[model samples]
Target: MTLMKAVTFRDFGGPEMLQLTEVARPEPGPSDVLIRIHAAGICYHDVLSRAGKIPRDKPGQILGHEIAGEIAAVGSNVSPDRIGERVVIYQRLFCGQCPYCLAGRQDLCRNSRVLGENGGGGYAEFTCVPAQNAIQMPDGLDMTTAALAVCPIGTSVRAALGVAKIGPGDKVLVTGSGGGLGLHQIQVAKSVNAHVIAVTSSDEKVDVIKQAGADEVIISPDLKFSREVWRLTAKQGVDVVLENVVTNTFGESLRSTAQNAKVVVLGNIGTRPVEVDPGLLIVRRIRIAGSGNATYADVRRSLHLLATGAVKPFIGRVLPFPDVGQGHALMEQKAVVGRVVLSGW
Candidate 1:
């Protein structure tokens, strides 16, 4: 029996529940490929899953979705030529037969399952995934940075560019600007020459957010940033709002947007119900869109951006896989400024 190191959780309460254990290595099916993970990006989703906030029925599940690795083995049906290729795993497992998948919108696949949300997660030495889900990493992109290509970069790209339709000379506002996705979104919005305003709750993140190319950084301790935004934009309001901390900031984000502006909701860290009054929407004509998981096309564009040096990754810390619990603890405490990557399992 082949054994591999994995961070598994049999209980759901806190970061202490994540245990380092030896588990049987998974084998690839005919259309699957086995990857030896080099780096896995820790996300807020993993923290929520550990706390039993995300829906999960079973225990003993590994909790990592952003994986970057080299192909260790390929199934009999897969091409042997793909062995040793560096790749990043797309965050979702989609059924190819779904209507959404057929329309090149796999992000909306009805039968899609998020990698870490169920099982066969990435917080391990080895993980088996469908050959189609493994995208080759672009040259000059390291494994550690590529690990974040899916969630932070790809998702933010979909939110800022695809959903919000950001363009040159546009005024863009980003909430939770110190987070993994927030940092990447700042860069994405800047890539097209948009004026970027970043909002963070912590004063410590103000400098870092400014360094990420934000034109202005606001420390909004009470989530009342719309007034500042209104003043900054000269009462015209911003053209788009990348709402990452949706539960707490959604209403204020809407108030900070110009007429017909789009508010793209990427994350809801509070995991609480949002209060929205439709009257504001009718008067402002603000469009609110929920940007879900990244599509395959989004990941491809993210890799291209990373390869071209258009967007740089901001990782707060990189720890050995045994310290997965510590990474989650930092996330739960909101101490991490950016993404926390785990390696060396």
Candidate 2:
């Protein structure tokens, strides 16, 4: 029996719960491929899971989803020639026959499951995923950059370009603008010629958000930035808003939009519910959309953007495989500027 090293939590409470363990090496199924993971991105989602917030991440389960690697082995049904291919893993295992998948909107696939929560997660030395979930890495793109393609990058693409449909000269406001998703979404919004206003709770991240292409940065530690947003836009407000910090800033995000603004809620950093003003929605004709995940096409677009230098990935720190707990600590403290990517087994 072959054993591989993986990071798993015996109990979900603290970063210390994440411990290295030897586990059975996973073998690919008939339609899957075994990948030798080179990089796995540590998201806030992982930190939440460690804190017992995400129920899908069971105790003792491997916990990382953003992954990039080389195809080391192919399943019986997969072509042997595909081995040695460098690829970025798509996080969801979507059933192709689902109605959403049939419409090429697999982002909403009902039968889909997230990789880290439901399958062979990437915290280990290797992981097995369906053959179709592997997206070829663009030429000259490194593993670390590819690791973020499907997550913050692709996710931002889906929210800004696809869901919000941001266009040239559109006014875009991004909440949590210094976060992993915000850094990339700023660039995505700018790529479409939008004027971006970045909002962050930390003053330390103000300059970082501007460096990431925010036309304006608002340091709103108290989560009240709507007034500044309105003043900056000359009372016009923004045309689109990408709300990455929903739990704390949903009301402000809604209040900071124009008459017919499109607001895309990317995540609720904390899972707690927020109070919504239905009157504000009715008066402004505000359209709020929630994106659970990105489509395969969004991942492909993110890769192309990365390759062409349209969107540069921001990695706060890169840790070795065994130091994954450190990444979680940094995330919990909100000390990382962008993302924490783990590499070097």
**Segments of candidate 2 deviating more than 4 angstroms:** none
Model 1, poorest ten-residue lDDT window?
Answer: 50-59
TM-score of 2: 0.98
lDDT of 1 by residue, 1-345 (tens): 999989898788878888899999999999999999999999898888888887753568888999999999999999999999999999889999988999889999988888978777889999999999999998878999999999889998888888888999999999999999999999999988999999998999998898899999989899899999999999999999998899889989989989999988888998999999899899999888889778888899989888998999999999999899999999888899899999896
- lDDT by residue for model 2 over 1-345, one digit each (tens)? 889999998997999998999999999999999999999999788788778887766788898889999999999999999999999999988899978899989878889888888547999999999999998997899999899999989999999988999999999999989999999999999998999999999899988898889999999889999999999999999999999889879999999999999999888888999999999999999999987577889999999999999999999999998999999999888989999999997
Total clashing pairs for each candidate: 0, 0
- What is the Cα-based TM-score of model 1? 0.98
Looking at model 2, residue 39 earns an lDDT score of 97
